[model samples]
Target: MSRNASASTRIRVAAGAAVLITVACTASATALDRSAETRSPGTPREAAALTGSAKLYRPLGDDITFTFDAHLAAEHRMDPAKATGTFRFSHYLDGRGAWAEGRIDCLLTGGKVAVASGVITRTDLPGAQGNRVGFTVHDVGRHDRLGYSWASVGNPVETKDLPKCVSAAPFEKVKNGTGDFRVLPWDPDFLKEG
Candidate 1:
């Protein structure tokens, strides 16, 4: 039973973190899109309690997130139109690094679907894996959006040491937002190859 408790704790912590990234990534992506086009962002909202869990939320304004979310579209089969979910955010690497996760919730598609989510961890001020995970629901134009993903390390090109995979242009936010990106039922990995 004791072992079970520890395992449970790990699961809970991991789950919380996943939720955070998902929410942050989605919100971040939207902000990125708006930033690039020089357009006003959607009505921002104070992140209410996502379900009953107590997950601290924060505005995503960096390249690590931008990469991860874009990577998702390139890698994970995340539907831009419906890949949103709740997330939990927590500090990592003593304030330099951060991690977040997104959990898929029920939707209007009709049939029962499996829940989904993603995580972005950065180290070296990036998180684990010396990188961050990003989830993005993108606007494919024509009022359509497909999902995006990117997993990378370093900051948004500002810092001299930032990696080639890093770009801050995608994740600049002016205010706090709520409810991460929506979720799709397709296998995420399949999208990466395309």
Candidate 2:
């Protein structure tokens, strides 16, 4: 072939190779993204985490009120031990209050519901010291409510037998302007580890 003709053929070959490489890279990237998207939401690493707090009040007969305050954090999976916060529960009657405080341990959340358990660090509630407590929170917009495992089990004398992260369905309707609870889902993009 003539020199110019040979040079032209080489140029076309190089251009075709460049196009093929580009197309292959694009396809590989697309496939990778699809695989990531197909992961199940129920996977522990992909499961929704619980955060935020809720404080609610329930009126008891004879001028008494029960108050519960829960502060939760389950944002990090890097260290499972970092997934907890504090909780305070109390009952007030005639200006006198009895209370319990503890550290939240296990948290599981899905959709509008979240279940959490903690070890009570201090409390004046009879037979409640150093015991595990479980509760459920339902964030139903303006009608948020909560349920305690002990209450759900008929207020039994002993509650240390309840399982972790287990609670009854939310039943106590939170009074308006009392408090709010939040259940945050994992955002894979933001949570991706390097």
lDDT of each: 0.33, 0.64
By TM-score, how accurate is candidate 1?
Answer: 0.20
Residues 1-194, model 2: lDDT tens digits: 99999999999999999999999999999987776676644444334444444456555622222333333332353333344667666656677756777887766665677777778888877777877877777778766888887875544236777666777778777666655666654333345687
Worst 10 residues of 1 by lDDT: 46-55
lDDT of 2: 0.64
Clashes of each: 46, 0
Q: What lDDT is reached at residue 85 by model 1?
A: 46
Among these predicted structures, which one has the highest lDDT? 2
TM-score of each: 0.20, 0.57
Clash pairs, candidate 2, are none
Tell how far residue 11 is off in model 2, in angstroms. 55
Q: Which stretches of candidate 2 lie over 4 Å from their true place?
A: 1-82, 153-157, 186-194
